[model samples]
Target: MKPFTDGDFIKTVIIQAATRWFPGEDNRRDFMNIVQNTRLSPATITRKVNVMADHVHEQLNIDLKKCVRFSIHLDESTDKTDTAQLVVMIRFVLENGSVQEELLELIPLTRKTTGLDVYLSKKNSILAHEVPLEKLVAVTTDDAPSMTGKITGFSGQCLRDPDFPRFLSFHCIITPRSILWENFKYKNRV
Candidate 1:
């Protein structure tokens, strides 16, 4: 049998590892078996997986630019590593009568996770890096006060002047009527 080259073995191991992480049955034994079968070094396999992710991200960036209007969904959650991270996802209708979603970014909000100003600044930076501000039609997020404030700040900053883009916010969990009623009640009490 011909000896498998280092690159070939690394690619095979990466594919196997990626399959385990992808949506499927959590067969730990099978995964471990595959890891043992591959002759490549673990570091090599890790690097290959990183490279594959980067390639996919580059391709998605090219495809997103062709979208006419796109909706962004932002949410933050703690990962298994206990790291507070912001996940920004984009949804758009393609030209071929299909809807597509891309995981635009996973930003580690290290210092900004606890502070309103820092969080908003980090969120704004994430938006600037992922999608063009002009292409965003709507943003959807949860009903967290900090998140709502950040969305408001983003709208104001982006639509500050006549030349800037006008983007709207859609709080998925809050109705406009309820918000108005709450505000009215608060004003009457004051």
Candidate 2:
């Protein structure tokens, strides 16, 4: 709470507190404790944070439109409470020759995550972003059956769909080959 007079600094404080799960009362107290007589209630902070998020989302959409080509990476895993979460990331090269990689979405699957489920969710996200499937050059995923299984996996579904553009599919390996080779050598030594 060191004296912060800048408006952007104030906004950053609110955003950080909100993201860090600070209670409403704590945020209010912190503002009150500030040297300046700034007024920031819990509700106001929440509203401001929401506005900031909306602005950032709009900027991301604009950036997506400027992408020359892009690739996606999908990974599905269960949370601590057994809730399935599909994490989608995107790597895109802008027209300016700069590449940007970002988290596109984290969709929580209310039901069990099947290959079809993943495909539909990803499709919706792509449509929402207004990104053409043709611009997608590749997709990377963890070699899970739901992601790679023929006829039932996400890539399989994409292959069957005529609307989907031709794109390379890859499996991201979790373990390094060197470590695997070392383990193999140790096991064979006995």
Candidate 3:
């Protein structure tokens, strides 16, 4: 057989496998060794993955541009490495009024993470996607102290920005209780 050179099939399988959450690296290596029989190197795989991600980024940005009004959801946390990572997602109403949410970015903080820093960084990233600032309708974030602090949180920082739209800000409602858990026992009727 003349080297499997079908980009379409390769892309398809990569997409399929990527969507799955399991299987350790060794398993993938073994499978590739047997089936692919000397296929793309790790660098090549990385390049292909980057290509796919770039295509998705472009497509998502285009969709955001078309949306008249959109909502944003943000989450920030420190990974095991102690790097602060921020996840950004957007929800928009499609032409048929069906809502869709797409993850936009995962920004890693190199230094101290503050409410103003996140606000500015997120604003730059969202605007870079060509989404009009005025069209922002909502901003949802977890009730982390840095996200909703009365004076120094992300929401407050955004509210103070003259360019940021007057959007509804909400905290993620993963449970009935607040993030500080003040309402946890009360909600459980304990």
| Tens-digit lDDT string for candidate 3 (1-190) | 2343454476558645743533677766666555455356556666788899899988887777777788888888788999999888889976667788988888887777788788778988977888877888899987677787757888898888888889898988573334448666567884
Question: TM-scores, in order shown?
Answer: 0.58, 0.73, 0.69
Q: Which rank order by TM-score, best down to worst?
A: 2, 3, 1
Residue-level lDDT for 60 in candidate 2: 83
**Highest lDDT model number:** 2
Question: Clashing pairs in model 1?
Answer: none
Candidate 2 whole-model C-alpha lDDT, 0 to 1? 0.82
C-alpha RMSD between model 1 and the true structure: 11.9
Candidate 1 or 2, higher TM-score?
A: 2
The lDDT of each candidate is 0.65, 0.82, 0.77
Which whole-number lDDT from 0 to 100 does residue 118 have in model 1?
31
Candidate 2, position 11, lDDT = 60
Worst 10 residues of 3 by lDDT: 1-10
Estimate the TM-score for candidate 1: 0.58
Ordering by lDDT: 2, 3, 1
At residue 70, give the lDDT of candidate 2. 97
Error of 1 at 60 (Å): 0.7
lDDT of 2 by residue, 1-190 (tens): 4332345566666656653555677776675456245545556566777899899889888999989999999988888999989889999999999999988899998875789999999999999988767888999987678898779899999888888888999988673555799889999995
Candidate 1 lDDT, tens digit per residue, 3-119? 323656555666677665755556655675676676565576567778998899777876776666778776766789887777778897656757789888777766645435434
